[model samples]
Target: MKLSVALIEPEHEVNVGHIARVMKNFGVNELFLVNPKFDSKKATIFAVHGKDLLTKSKIIYFKDLRKFDLLIGTTAIYSNNRSNVIRDSINPSQLVKIIADSKQSICFLVGRESTGLNNTELSICDIVVSIDTGTAYRTLNISHALAILLYEIKKNSFQKKTNLATVHERVLLIDYALKLAKVSGYRRHKTSLLAMALKRFLGRNLLTSKETMLMVTLFRQALLTIERKRRKMF
Candidate 1:
């Protein structure tokens, strides 16, 4: 999976430079800035060896986020008062599965240095993740949170398949399994539970298209056999 780090309306140039340094430290090179408020020299000084990263970082608008398969918003204050389902943020650890599953582009979006992502930004995100900082300090430095999130992403990124399963293949695996289950005498509720569990299991594993197709073939064969037996019984 390709990972890009984006800062939106960042007011501090030094932090942006420092974030670029940490991104290089973790081998993340794609940096994006949206209408930043920092000077170039201050950024170059703090970036140090990461000047190349800062140099290549893109100056983008929010509309440009469509370039990614997933646009993730980062927040420090994960309030329980999330107005709706889309606003709720998951823990960073839970995001590892998403990184492991797809071979698509991802953008990690962080808002201004003074404040975390606003509701409007968060609303457009595919996912929102928050780092857990205890009550001592409710929020984290934008750079610090980026470091933690990047570390988690890098940890799970080592799992490589020759050809990773696409979203369609992933969905089809469960669909085929459910058809096989229903035709082979499983109750609807029971089959539903099984499918849910299977989806969870499959979601965490790095499966290739060939592996998924093999399972699909097996399920199809089983369903055909079940159909023949039912015809004879009738």
Candidate 2:
């Protein structure tokens, strides 16, 4: 699993630098900044040994964020009745569990220091996670938020032993299934439904590369069987 810490429209140079430090401490290397306020000098001072994270960081527009499969936006205030899944602000352990279950690349989004994520940004995230804090004013500095999140993500989760299948691999699986469905004379709508169902099922399994290859082979054999049956009908 590739874990990235993404700061969106950060307004402080010191904060960006500090967040990079925390990311390094927790073994997180991918630092992404969107519309940052400061240059490398300010960030380098605070980053200490983590200057590499700053240097290698990817700067991107908001639209490019969709490339990540799991986007987690951090917020201080919970919008009542807006989300389908609500839990008490996530503790470090809970954060680990969520990450363990996720099969795709994960992005942790930290908003600007002055305000937490706006409604527009939160709408795109799959989950809005909050750090549990006792203060009446729940806001945390952007760097502090990164520290908490990185600590949770790095601690206690099983290290990924094998690389995840790429997007191309997943697409190939879907395309193979679609072709089989077509030859079976399945209706177009039903074919879409069946393909989606299969995708969801595969996603839930979090299949390893070898496992995915095996499944693809099985799917191929099933398609051949269907084709044979089609030939018999002619």
Runs in model 2 lying further than 4 Å from the true structure: 82-92, 101-103, 158-234
lDDT of 2 by residue, 103-219 (tens): 578888888888867867865665567876887877888788778777666556565535555555665777887887788787886764565455444443445667677767887
Q: Write the per-residue lDDT of candidate 1 for residues 18-51, one digit (tens) a residue.
A: 8999999988889988888889678889888888
Model 1: lDDT equals: 0.77
Worst 10 residues of 2 by lDDT: 81-90
Candidate 1, 89: how far from true, in Å?
Answer: 0.9
Number of clashes found in candidate 2: 0
In angstroms, the error of model 1 at 9 is 0.6
Q: TM-score: which candidate is best?
A: 1
Error of 1 at 94 (Å): 0.7
Could you give me the TM-score of model 2 versus the true structure? Answer: 0.64
TM-score of each: 0.67, 0.64
